[model samples]
Target: MGYNFSRFTRGIAPGSRIFAADGEPLSNDMLRAAVPSIFATEAHESRSARFAPVPTVTVLDGLRAEGFEPFSAVQARTRAEGFEPFSAVQARTRVEGKAEFTKHMVRLRHRSLTNTTGDSFEIVLVNANDGTSAYQMIPGFFRFVCENGLMTGETFSEVKVRHSGNAIGEVIEGAYRVLEDAPLVAEQVASWKAITLQDGERLALAESAHILRFPKADQDGEAPAPVQPEALLRPRRSADRATDLWTAFNVVQENTLKGGLTGRVRNAEGRLQRRTTREVAGIDQNRSLNRALWLLTQRMAELKSA
Candidate 1:
């Protein structure tokens, strides 16, 4: 699936329309009309005591002051029986020519808009009323080709702050640092581009990834079932077919995220059954898998350098 950065870009456009796709200014009126929970107060009552309320519009205003525009915004749809399926809203409304739709997560890309290679820096802020997750800010690169939000660093690289006073300042500052460090990311990508991968090394990385995706059985249990490493290494796009470590890593990463590669596994009845692999969709799993692939490539490059 192509990851559309249009959702990230629409918010930052010069004439942003964050409320309706019809091109209107993003305002409290629009937000409240579209999603009432954003403006809900204790007077409306009944939120869990643990709900650290971060008023969404307030944060957007702060971002605007700092020159960061909202491109996409969505409300967390209640899984409660009646309402239609909803997702975490993207952070901005649409301007005349911007993208459309909603999600609960608000994304703000760096205003500087410097492209390190084909990727631009972005920060995603996730807020939830259901107590399932904390309000947190994530830093990542938005790849133009595939529209993938490639996260940097480890799973815990996110900066989590309470919704209380100055959270916006902390978020802006954290994002500033993340964008400023884009050079480091560029350096690593450059190194990977320079490092060629031997067939053996590439296969080894693929084998490790297969294990990560499908772990071996417990010590006392039967031996783990087998899966072809090539299944995981297959390139999903033509651009990923090169022999360098960077290309290998991108191939693996895209395949992992895109899934659908088939493998045989033991069913509950101990019969071998062909099953399609699941896409890496959850926030935690995407981070873990992407970071693991990146680290694997980094290690290979380091070894090659030495």
Candidate 2:
């Protein structure tokens, strides 16, 4: 029941009589007033997420054509709505200097499958620190000696570590350097193909991306690949070397002392009490021990430095 100036205007000027679809006269003033209420219902306050203000290109105008959106309508309309440019997202889509939402990291790491055997693969974020390693700047350091970096001259990379397998065998961590050669890489690629897998474990491996150059021993008829020392540069290999050195040195010292001295050698602490245990029943036990354990430990620690 809107008032019409023509009917109620007593004498307001006449133009079109605004009418409902049924042709009932509706006043022009009421139509003008209703537009505001309609717009109020529709123009909500959306959070602005761009470094630059989104162009007010009506609801239908294209961004680039209007010069308001970071990308043109053709571009933005094709991608997800939130798919802002990386730079724009970093600049404006912030929660205290960080994007509220962004791409996440996917990483490659080496895991020792067994004491003598091991494998490397990719793992999604598994630890808070791995989530923060880039900021920390320090390189990977973990127990079980994944690889000897410095000594072997191996380049380092992010490697998430965990102790599995009941850790019964030699505690070891393996480090890997990516190969640059296409064919060998292709071969290794074929090697990591899916094998039989146990429950709740991994079997397939993404191709190794680490590319390091080192010296390699001259081979026979086979085409000599990039001359880097693949085995020597491996962390496990270098750690093994340090370990072997430790063992050999201990063996020589043990044999020399065993034959040259009866039991305990006298030192500045002369004639220290040698509590000898006697197994009267010819007790026999076999033990394999590394003489260079400390040296290996030191060497391993140093290798990880690089």
Candidate 3:
């Protein structure tokens, strides 16, 4: 059973790994059995001031350029073994200045979908040492999830596992651009494991030049929205052009968008250019979900004029 907290106590204490899958307390033995080795000798560091993630662009946009794909893992079952590629939902992401990133181990269950019935599992991101400010990813977390005693394919990205619960995640296939995808292991009892980057992955990304790169996230309207005209997708085969354009535009935004710790605060001359819209036209939902918030404000004026 999970521990009942006192009114004086605010929340679940770290190391209190109660299985959100059920009410059972996740024991240390269970944790070790899932991941035999634990993060040991991890250097101590102070917490970075909390900052809400800007949006999904942090990983999505970057991965997309690297041929990354996303899916809603728990929402539908037709693609249980894969991704649905639709059923879009709002994206939430933020970044703080130079926060220390940590690696985490995940426990997985495969047939839990059939025998269990509901969501398979969720991703919990908290301090591996002491849990706090837990952030949720989505249907799942971690680049790799163990299924029925075997590891699923890996996601082409690695993120600071945030949150304290769990979510579903889709397995991604890609070149060894992401270190996690490398066929190397670091199981030294004294060392933390990490994936090494492959040379081909490096060359592929190096060839994909940045169309729009911003040092910091300027309010969307602060600068004119840069326009692209099939420069990247010119040789494109075929798909929903609108969705393509939208996703493409997101490609631009994700690649270009910067967040809080961006920009220089020199004297008063270089103050960030912040803009507020009174009325504008054609600000339809042409880009990605991450742009929704920015689009909302921009559209306020265009909508009024419409």
Candidate 4:
């Protein structure tokens, strides 16, 4: 599904709407309004009898009992246009009861970790009742400076629980497993902060990110990147102007994901037209890009240390 990001709006990705609270736990009413799928009581009809249904609210309640409170919730909409019959059928199946089975993500923070300043760890929960997704727990960082949510690299293990018997128990277990790695994420951030990158190194990272965002042409050929790599290096705020690897990563990440960079692209008629990059809106796209960027930064840090 294509996703669109709206910085000025409540929605984060296209086909998705997000509600986040500022240092406060989101209420049931808030989550229901933003991502009703989280409150789903049953699985979609498409799922086979073998597919055990576990409501996300069950997991949320389980986490709450463990002192974790959800602050952000988002759900994917099943609306789409398809030309093929099979595609149309799939779309219909997804939309039939999408409100009860669509993919949703919730971000929660443990009460014990609340006092930490600068950046705080969040347990990002992703699930769907339509058999499209399993219970996924990923380590996320909430940056106070930019109000950005960042997923950590693969070095920080992601816990997943398949839709089956005892899934809720497994998910609750996985949440704490992810929580245990919070300090390690903080250590990684501190190390990145300490490693200052020269302008060339920063540019190299941006160039790599540019390629990730806009790949080279295939046999069919594609337009060049909408913006130069240097554009990604531009800081949104003074706090992000530092030359450290962490700051540089944030600069590239924000620019790449939030987009809105003005540039020229060749039209079908071969004329240059002004275009602005779109925000990374798809949940899968967002997570994939965020994780890839994190991996790139990790590799850069490793190379620098070596």
Best by TM-score: 4
Q: How much does each candidate deviate from the true structure in C-alpha RMSD?
A: 8.4, 32.7, 21.2, 4.2
On a 0 to 1 TM-score scale, where does candidate 1 land against the true structure?
Answer: 0.68
> lDDT, candidate 3, residue 45?
38
Tell me the deviation in Å of residue 124 in model 3.
9.8
Rank by TM-score, descending? 4, 1, 3, 2
lDDT of candidate 3 over 17-39, digit per residue (tens): 22223323333355433322122
Evaluate model 3: give its TM-score: 0.21
**Candidate 2: where are CA atoms >4 Å away?**
1-100, 103-141, 144-306
Give the winner by TM-score: 3 or 4: 4
Candidate 3 RMSD to the correct structure: 21.2
lDDT values for all models: 0.55, 0.19, 0.23, 0.77
Clash count for candidate 4 is 1
Range of the 10 consecutive residues with the lowest summed lDDT in candidate 1: 93-102
The predicted structure with the larger lDDT, 1 or 2, is 1
lDDT string, candidate 4, 1-306, tens digits: 001111212223243455454667887777777677898888888889889877999889889989999877767645545422222212122465565688777888898886455777888888888888888998888776777778887989799888888999999999999999999998998999999999999999999998888776222666677887899998989998899999999889888888778988777798999987777655666778888888999999999999
lDDT, residue 282, model 3: 9
Model 1 bad stretches (over 4 Å): 1-51, 69-79, 82-104, 114-116, 155-158, 216-227, 265-272
Q: Write the per-residue lDDT of candidate 2 for residues 94-126, one digit (tens) a residue.
A: 222212121111111222211232221221111
Off by over 4 Å in 4: 1-16, 80-95, 216-220, 268-270
**Model 4 clashing residue pairs (backbone):** 4-14
TM-score of each: 0.68, 0.14, 0.21, 0.89
- lDDT, candidate 1, equals 0.55
